[model samples]
Target: MNLETLKQGRNYCKSLTLNDRKILEEMLEDDFYIKFHELFRYMIDEDLKLEQEWFG
Candidate 1:
């Protein structure tokens, strides 16, 4: 997720019930970009698709 999606997901998850948040948090951890330092390095394409694993 990008900065916006990360923030939005956090807010959205906050509004969810505990059970839902538990699942959502796990999902986010599995895929969200928690490390900004490695963002550019890990990014696959510069069409700015940071969500993808670097293929470049």
Candidate 2:
């Protein structure tokens, strides 16, 4: 769980955008690891949805 590292698509402190900040804020304000899982899940899910809608 190296949050400092840049992932393939998202969740990098240095690479985060404005909207990413909002999502991060939402994630950090929740109940610890469960929220962290939800946040990570949401990131992957949204990326999948966008890809499906755009290129499927």
Query: What TM-score does each of the candidates earn?
Result: 0.28, 0.34
Residues 1-56, candidate 2, lDDT per residue (tens digit)? 42222234243223345586567556656666563665455554454212222221
lDDT of candidate 1 vs native? 0.37
**Scored by CA lDDT, what does every candidate get?**
0.37, 0.44
Any residue pairs clashing in model 1, and if so which? 44-54
Best lDDT among the predictions, by candidate number:
2
Q: In candidate 1, what are the lDDT values of residues 1-56, reduced to their tens digit?
A: 55454333432322334564455445446545445434322221121332223222
Candidate 2 Cα errors over 4 Å, as ranges: 4-14, 32-56
